[model samples]
Target: MSLYKTEAIVLKYYELKEADKIIVLYTRQHGKVQAVANGARKTKSRLAGSVELFTYSDFLLYQGKSLSTISQTEIINSFASLRDDLFKMAYASYVVEVVNEFTVDEEKNEPLFALLLATLYMLDRGEELELATRFFELRLLNLLGYRPQLDACVDCDLDLAKIDKVKFSSKLGGVVCADCALEDQYAMRINKGTVATMERLLEIDYKKLDRLKVPESTRQQLAKILPNYLQSIIEKKLKSLDFLKTLTMTN
Candidate 1:
């Protein structure tokens, strides 16, 4: 066994026993980590607050052959505001869930780690949640090597400006030019503003997301297009998405 320290954000957790918990963390130095946090369920336990979902903290761990043990923890940013509001909680949950789905254990993903931290901070501080999430999704896809082709047709080399029509093809991993529409018959029809929004999202800093105003029509298009593209990549619908859908219905 070896001892090491890292900063991580709680992704999710489960009760391991009466008092212990299994915490899923996305670490800065280590990608995704699961370790036992003993006595975390107890009200008096020091690990209680630090292990809560979305808490960014410093940890001292003992790496074991089969699993790691969280020996100590200190909260860096609790981001408690996200848990206090249902609307914020729901959208942020979807964001973290996407990160959890796309990553594997023990991989060092510094860029993704920074991106997620920025996103959670944005959510916590009450930035425009919808636009923040859209930015997070686009940036996350880029970090995971799944950046969709927006500059030209995924099926053909043609520049999209020349084409009067463009359709988003998740299978082809980008927009298909008008000439290549038949490539994916189920391809999503996209408009100029929507395409421009996505392109801008790809390039903009997540912190400056507020500066880019997204019209409701474009937001609706993004709501449809991005998730469909992600579903194609991941091959399964995220559970958190269903939760978001339910929230929308009740509102």
Candidate 2:
């Protein structure tokens, strides 16, 4: 058919019949793309390095009837450091997994693409990995139109700053004031500190994540809350998250 080129980060890959591999990528221009890397499993295959998970690369693709084929590739940033550390790799995998699971083929989302790239860069460079992951989750939710309302009650629309006790309702999708909590029986009590942390994380730039200190209690609160929020949004448990929890517990 036709040939095209674009910048992409390899999300994941699976072995194909014989020496080929099926690569899932999130491209800067094309959103998510699935393509075949012919003979990629073979030792001498040119696509081997370019198609590895988390590798940012430029690719030449051949448009086919059912799937695109990666004809040529050049490495941009392999994010080599992620491979050197188990924890970093696990976090990175969770990031990519979120991108891969939530996105649809060829759905162009530049902000999402940028967020993923920036997050990977932070992970690779050894920045605040935990904060970065939380920030990414919050931002990703906003970008995808699932942003939780933190400033006010989801039901009554009252400003949370004026409210003394605020409860977070994952079912209602945001903070609920004391009066509104009765309406949402499943609302869980959220400490003011964790609420503040979430608000700050949502507003701060990704570049400054390392500068934002999260107290152990706040971090634990976030570690509990954000994943539950994300799981509620996605409606299923993330496999990578299970592995990440295992890694965290072991370490």
Best by TM-score: 1
What value does the lDDT take at residue 210 in candidate 1?
A: 88
Poorest lDDT segment (10 consecutive residues) of candidate 1: 242-251
lDDT of 1 at 109: 96
RMSD list, candidates in order: 1.3, 1.5
lDDT of 2: 0.89
TM-score of 2: 0.94
Q: What's the lDDT for residue 104 in model 1?
A: 92
- Where does candidate 2 clash, by residue pair? none
Backbone clashes in each candidate structure, one number apiece?
Answer: 0, 0
RMSD of 2: 1.5
State the lDDT of candidate 2 residue by residue for 1-251, as single tens digits: 89999999999898999999999999999999999999999999878889988999999999899889999999999998887789999999999988988899999999999999999999988888888899999999999998999888888899888888888888888999898888867677888888889989889988788789889888877777777888887788888898888898787
